[model samples]
Target chain A: MSPSIMTKGAIDCDIHPSVPNIEALLPYFNDHWRDTISQRGVHDLQTIAYPKNAPLTARPDWRPKLGMPAADANTISTQALDTFQTSIAICNCLYGVQLLMSEDLAAAFASAVNDWMIAELLNKDPRLRASIVIPTQNSEMAVAEIERVASDPRFVSILMLVMDEKPLGRRSYWPIYAAAQRHNMPICVHAGSAYKHPVTSVGWPSYYAEDYASQAPAFHNMVSSFICEGVFSEYPDLKVVLAESGFSWLPAHLWRLTKFWRGLRAEIPWVDRTPTEIARDHIRLTLQPVDAPPTSEQLERLMDHMGSDEMIIFSTDYPHWQFDGVDVIPDGISKELATKIMVENPKNTYPRLQ
Target chain B: MNIQLMDRVATDQKIKLAIADCDIHPAPKSVPVEIYPYLSKRWQDYMETYGIIYRQGFPTGPAFPKGQPNAARRDAYPPGGGKPGSDLDFMRSQHLDANNVQLGILNPLSCGQGVQNQDFSAVYCNAVNHWQIAEWTSKESRLKASLMVPYEDPSASVKEIDLWGGDSNFAQILLLSRTAEPLGQRKYWPIFEAACRANLPVAVHAFGYGGAPVTGGGWPSFYIEEMVGHAENTQSLLTSMVFEGVFERFPTLKLILVEAGFAWLPALSWRLDKLWNRMRAEIPHVTRPPSELIRQHVWLTTQPMEEPEPREHLLDTIEWIGWEKLLFATDYPHWDFDEPSRALPIRVGKEQKEAFFLKNALELYNLN
Candidate 1:
């Protein structure tokens, strides 16, 4: 996987530009929040979603000696942009704002993360775009934040974690969805947790490996929720991007959902088309951390099972190690499929990316 | 059990293997009465007065009610008007004899797994254990029982396994895939320990009403979400067991996933191995790679099979998962039943087909 087959102008759908520390976000915070955070003597709110030194958290060679990896726009340009020759990269700053218990604090921290993303990363590079990190604790606040920052063309999507306080498709969150659709932004459910609930329904898993492995299934349930909750019917044009969610489990998942929908469509009559059709039209997934079979033939067949090349967009999940070397694209994907994934699908997914 | 009642004939492929259906549900005609003959009088009276509560909301029904009545194929209901799988004669005609099933393992989903009353749960499980033999397995030679135990109470679970574990008629120890905690936790190990002593494999069927939300985030809207959630729940448990060293602790124990889809097997194995390779110190008990552990220990039944648009893609996954690890299952009488003859890929060679249809179940259950 170390060799470069990647062509230029590929749009990396998900890349995390880590906030260096608590100090970096302090200026973006309001006078009340800035002094309140300092008065309380708080430290970096970075959740253990990614351990600082874990190999999965950061590729060893990409790690800086001084601070958090990919904390700066310069490192991202050289390490991700120049290497993959990507024209545009979306900075989904996964700092721990959503981890706050108090809705006010969550809103404050989320606002700070968004502002910092604009000032520190998105503005610094013409190639960098970002998702507006919303305070998911309260829908009104989340929507307010969306309205505030969404006007900036640099922000392409609304960022929410996959594992959150409630299923993201519930009625309570409709306001946020309404705001996102009104602004022509997709809801990007990135792979992270709010820590409010166990990563698994059974309870918290013992190892990070178990937590990480649980993400694909989490995506399965999330997609089902969105489709069955009539999120698509309510807002027909809205698209949801499952960032850092693996792809292999999808064909079977869609099959299962659509199969049941045939017998059980009456339960949710709004789902007029097959669930697979709904997903293909509205949902998209990132390419890196590919949880594919060992052979290229198998990978190709698996992608074929996706029923459309348009559902997957190009992503390196940069600075974090998904695969070693430049062989970012899985070996067996056909040149035509690769071109569709790299250029066309992404530009179509994010209107701003075009 | 009458041979003359058999409606359908076996295909040559089925006849050669003497195919086994790994998942067969055996419910009671009436909840307490059918089981009453087996239970002690005190528990019977207790059931009559209070009844069982699953502890999740809605005492009368499942948390997420099924779209179909009894969650069964409409054709599965008996002509005499009882729940599906309740009458042996109807089952023999419709499923067993019709499919030419050489051996069928009864899953009996209503076997007191999610019962709130632990004391009553223990006794109810014990009663169902006897009732299965009396009602179906004892009468039907082609059928076997999945020994029911109160998994919520492992000590009691061990007691149930102690009584029926050695019986060949009872093929495997039944535990739901969704438990109160991850199935791999040490609290549940004693059940596995008892299972090993009896030389019975633990089959984690895809049903558990352990009062937990079906999904990690929160409750989902529809039954469709719950239906797709089986794979997710099972995959999490598989990861939990591997990382928590359930396999290493009980090296000989085997696991079977019933009604849980197996398409994600190859990817999960790879992901688990990749993650565990870098984080071995956290769980030193798992000496081998997670994928290797999965290969040695885990097996899945092909039912509600992954029907990708181009069907051979299913075969491509099975090729990676290895044909030997799969056991053919119909999830008999369920609405989502898979007909064995049509379910498997046509491209698979005869030898691999034999392994999937018959050999895997035989070797896993140690039945002839």
Candidate 2:
């Protein structure tokens, strides 16, 4: 049962529509790459980001008997869209296409994944929208993929992982940012890493739990990179969304960043405003893993420090096991705040949704 | 005469207010020269010739450069023209005498902790400890030292802890936030064990050369990340220590996280507890909830304090983390140093304020 105060027709900003396997995308690929992939015996190009056996990778009820969880569009539509009464569900595909070492192979895989998503999932639901996945290994190729896919209105945003070879705000990635801005696309940075480096600063963590929680600081570090490297100042219109990245750490993270920016603004002269101001204007986060105290009353107290209502967009993060059955919205969110998060915020964030 | 008596009583109360400053950074007046007296001629020559051994990434300056010059406040520079924290008389007048800081703990950062030569690290760590004794702690009775250690080498760290051996002048053992590996790895377990035996709580201050990327994902593009980024290291080490069962292995061992922000603690604990509840089977040693373990073992110093907007939200976070676990710090001489009088934005009651600024540090150090 949905909460009594649930808002109907809400926009679900994040929901993973599983790619069944490499075979699912085979039809989308050209014969040259398809034949090569088959001969090379490259069966699964998956990252440790969401281990298939990890319970968090799928809610037990959502998993099918035969195939991967949420592989069927109707399953997601019924479980995520219909169950929550959401009108729009943005499908964030976590296929690990970008993890390929060869830039050409990665770009080819990205194109194939986008094509497969369109024919498979978006075609089935009018309410579905998606983000274009890019191989960050080559920004030029990544840009070309964005240019190729931008014409479709259903591809509402662009997807980048929080952890990759380098910080997303580096100058090498600027060309892709320019393309994103041109298409009026928000770069959706989801909580997954290429695992090119250790999961935490000291070194690799032993448990999957530590690696999962490490995403909060990883998101925090990228936000600092974005603000200090003048990403916002250079593009002016570019927006970044942190999906499945916890927000409870954000208030303190921003406070620390804003303090340093004030003291050290002269070093990065292009960062004309405090990090908090820049983040409020340019950055947004998906609402999952609220990561607050148990009570909604306490969550309100924690969220009051976020400084703006518009920064959070609603998301169930379906099939991720972030929460239990049907408790999509955490308790203690006021009805007015819920409306803003579910309806107004997502619309304002993604202009395509309007 | 009646008015004069009341004024004297008020003055006595002001004088009676004890301010134990936990995180005071003391710099050597001159790098090699100041440490020479403690080092023997062989190591002294080695120090002069070789200098510091760092990688090509940051051979000359910091790889992650601090924002300000010497990472210090402009006014913090001594009038006599040394680094902000180098001169003793200047520090006393500018900070301690000025602010009524009665109990100041010296955490001298230039102890050659990052010098890649672990042998020199042991040599220089000993030199730095002696330098603290002669220059700061021994000279001023109100000031105390954190026994410096070459924490990169676990055996060296234990040696230094044993050398100081809970000397009255040194109140705690000083390790850094970043290290060659996570502090809890079995390699560094001996340091925690030694600290407990010496009856000294270990204070993990905010900066070091960990030989790994400052961030988990790799090097960030900017310098600001260096300032707030190590708190992420603090977060990692806390999880590492607890999950590795370091706390369980050494029950009396305590940690003072200096210059590591406390506002993030409640949220981090919540995340760890969630994992502990589900993944306890993977690590059978961690018997209780992480928050309970954290509250029992960890004490956080407030420096470069987090400034959440509407300010009062800090109160809610502090409530969750527990106010008693906080030790007020100045991070003196650093560019973003917090002043005790106005450090906290929220209203703290008189009794609790006393605990925050004074009693907490004293009790933690066993000084009171």
Summed backbone clashes in each candidate are: 0, 1
How far in Å is the alpha carbon of B92 misplaced in model 1?
1.4
Tens-digit lDDT track for model 2 on A243-265? 99978888888888887777778
Candidate 1 pairs with clashing backbones:
none
Clashes counted in candidate 2 amount to 1
lDDT of candidate 2 over B100-218, digit per residue (tens): 89899889885778668889889888988888888888889999998888888889889889888958988999888887777778998899999999999999998887777877667
lDDT score, residue A155, model 2?
A: 96
Candidate that scores best on TM-score: 2
TM-score of every candidate relative to the true structure: 0.94, 0.95
Tell me the TM-score of model 2.
0.95
